[model samples]
Target: MRAMAYESYGGSDVLKEMRLPLPKVAPGEVLVKVECAGVNPVDWKIMAGGLDALMDVVHPVVPGWDVAGTVVRLGIDVPEFAEGDEVMAYARKDYVHGGTFAEYVSVPVRALARKPASLGWEQAAGLPLAGLTAYQLLTRLDTGPTDTVLVHGAAGGVGSLGVQIARSLGARVIGTASPHNHERLRGMGCEPVEYGDGLTERVRALAPDGVSVVADFVGGVLDVTLAVLRDGGRHASIADHSVLGSGGQWMWVRPSAADLTELARLADTGALTVPVLRTFPLHELPEAFELSRSGGAAGKIVVRP
Candidate 1:
């Protein structure tokens, strides 16, 4: 199989295309022919050795977590899916290696879900990671119609999905972004506020009594969260671990077939949208990594095999 892998940690420059053997499927896994692979900021972050302390790294690592594809074969004792099933998964494992940025990948059944019929291959590939992150964060906070939720970094990949999920649950959403992204956010049912200086004042103007929930996708804004959050309000951060010290929970997204299924249902029902900004062929992963690092765009990036 043809795939991209990095023998050692560095930057996008370390990624190289090569021929590798197909992965051996474990008892609870399935082999998938990769149609598309979703690229997240974490892909580049892992490539740069940013997660060295948290997860063990194996050499010749293929860096990707989100995939949308078809099942070619099932492993022993598997009964949930058939050989021809269309699927998508947040394919994170116990260690870093054997990922979705290849012609094929082996995914555990626990992380796999059927693709939403309403989405294209690229859009479905974009769903597992960012969509699951937003869904898990908001649902854990128990946001509902009676709550006013504030989302930081609302124009980016995860933030945008969060806005839609919160809206689907009947919550009024206030999101932080620049002037250029405000109109687009409004289309997603989010009231947009400019970030940076005076962010607290702007959010307070929208919810003077303080928002009932605050979700921080972008880090370093604890002051704003503390300022605009109501007393005993819910708060969580994916980017800021220091939030643990300030009465807010810090979370990492887990792979769950159930949660991913719910997100797919939302997509099929027209209640959620996966915004894919651009895509690159398998060999052009370095360019995709650079694009994600620059933050020049505000939607998900995907790679085609």
Candidate 2:
């Protein structure tokens, strides 16, 4: 198998294509022939050793967590799926190694879900990490039809999905993005607001009583969140862990087959969608990592193997 790996933590420059042995499938896991791998900011961050204190990294680390592929073999006691099944997973393990950036990855059965039939391979690959983050945040906030939800960084990967999921839950969504992305957010059933000076005022103008939930994908917006949230309103952030001490949840997405299945259902029913900003071949992972680090892409970056 060929994989993009870095023996030491650094930048995109450290990533290189190398031939490696296929991963050994453990009990309750499945080996998947990779079709596409989704690249997230965390991928580049991990490559740069940003998460050194939180998780252990094995040398020659393969750096990707989101994948859409086909099962080639099932590990012992895995009765839910068989060979040749189309699947997708947020394939994060307890440690960092043996990831979806390779030609094949071994994913635990608990993290696997059937790929949504309505999405293409690239789009399905883009869904797991971003979609799961959005879904989990909204779920933790207890979003409902009666709520007005505000989404920060609404045009980016996770924020874009958050807007759609909130809408699907019957909540009225207010999303912040640049002027160019306002029309796109509007198309996703959100009232778009530009993020900058007077952000609170802009949000207040839309929902005078203040929003019932605030989901912040962008960091350093704690003041904005506090300004626009109603009393006792729920709030959460994946980027800002400090929110935990301030009466808001600081969330990290966990792999869940059930939640991924709900996202697939939403996709199949046209209620949710994954947007792909660009695609790169497996060997061009360095370019993909650089693009993801730039944070300028309008949607998820995908690597096709």
Per residue, candidate 2 scores C-alpha lDDT tens digits across 57-76 of 89899999999999999899
Reference-based TM-score of each model: 0.99, 0.99
lDDT for model 1, on a 0 to 1 scale? 0.95
Q: Which segments of candidate 1 are over 4 A away from where they belong?
A: none
The reply for model 2, stretches above 4 Å from the true place, is none
lDDT of 1 by residue, 1-305 (tens): 99999998998899999899999999999999999999999998999999999999998999999999999989998899999999999999999999999999999999999999999999999999999899999999999999999999999899999999999999999999999999999999999999989999999999999999999999999999999999979999999999899889899999999999999999999999888899999999999999999994778899999
lDDT of 2 at 111: 96
**Clashing pairs for predicted structure model 1, backbone only:** none
